[model samples]
Target: MRIIGLLLLTGSLTMGLAACGGGDEQSTAKQEKAVETSTEAKAGVEEFTITAKNWNFSSDKEIVVKKGEKVKLNLVNKEGLHTIKNDELGIDLTADKPAEFMADKTGEYVLKCSTVCGATQDHEGMEISLKVVD
Candidate 1:
């Protein structure tokens, strides 16, 4: 009779522990998902669109953004195919794809056309500036 009572107690304890462990695992998963959602919401992004034409960019000559902010740059080719690149900021903008990065450094970055589309002077003069401020 004593052995029977001990066995019942042990079985009940084991079942209780299993239930608690499963609940804890589910709770942990929910907490992790909430943290991920909060982090994504905290990350702010800034987007800018620049249009390129035959000889120059039709949009603004300079783009300004805050340091440490995420930047999304879109290049729209209105007339011809062109490519712009900046080694310092690791920016490569083309008519096919866009560029995205964090503006961590505060300075002036010059983005120039890397593709030869027309005359030397036109390609040489085609450029834009990106300014990151505090």
Candidate 2:
């Protein structure tokens, strides 16, 4: 019957729309989980190891910590030479040694590669987010 064929087509369309609608809800849930995880990061002397190669950072996860905590960063450069620097936090680390800085304030800070290791670029692929929460 004509009505049966039309009903089947309508059902298929409705199922497709439901699948699309679920995508947004899943994304929102992921965002919330990230928030919870960031807040629950281990406090006091947070140690992080970063691999520096291919002109990019190996770890893109945001460095989250409470204010007034110490951030201990260990850098390893497998490709070329590199250093990490954040002007706001006065963190300048060379490949020769590790870096430790105080998360003095509660705000968002950007860390970048200050050393000129890459080609024709002031900042290589080393920009990452640093968040200090109260």
Candidate 3:
């Protein structure tokens, strides 16, 4: 019984010592690096607000963006779940929270709601034209 008690006391002390070591310094350094990287990546983005209702998009109904510019497309849903997809940019954004995409090409791309909803916005076929100018 005395040997068992000694072993338990030693094990507890070893674990306590390990927990008090400087592992938190490494964790804090990594977190700071990640925040810096994210800030730099979003430094020069041109932001826009897009509102999605039951079957349509409001506030900048059609997008006219400049090519080679980083666009931050912010989407707000007020009615239901909506999806905006652009085939050229390979974007399929869901309207749950805010979202963003880059405008890098100079041409016309078809934008539309990919959500299958009720009999509004032309029966779930609401569309928008995105024209990127050089």
Candidate whose lDDT is highest? 1
How far residue 48's Cα lies from its native spot in candidate 2, in Å, is 0.9
C-alpha RMSD in Å of predicted model 1 compared with the true structure: 16.2
TM-score of candidate 1 against the unseen true structure: 0.64
Q: In what order do the candidates fall by TM-score, top score first?
A: 1, 2, 3
Q: Which digits, one per residue and each the tens of the lDDT, describe model 3 over residues 14-120?
A: 99998888774665456445434554677787555556677677654457878887765655555676777777786676644444667877898776787875676
- Candidate 1 lDDT, 1-134, residue by residue in tens: 99999999999999999877866458545644543454466557676667778888755345899999998776766667888899888889875576888999999888898889899998899988889999
The local distance difference test score of model 1 is 0.77
> Top model by TM-score, which number?
1
Residue pairs with backbone overlap in model 1: none
> Candidate 2's error at 29, in angstroms?
38
Cα displacement (Å) at residue 125, model 1: 0.4
Among all windows of 10 consecutive residues in model 1, the one with the lowest summed lDDT is 31-40
For candidate 2, the lDDT comes to 0.71
Q: Compared with the true structure, what per-residue lDDT tens digits does model 2 show for residues 87-125?
A: 788888665576788888999877788887757563455
Q: Which ten residues in a row have the lowest lDDT in candidate 3?
A: 30-39
When superposed on Cα atoms, how far off is each prediction in RMSD?
16.2, 11.1, 10.7
Residue 61, model 1: Cα distance from true site in angstroms: 8.8
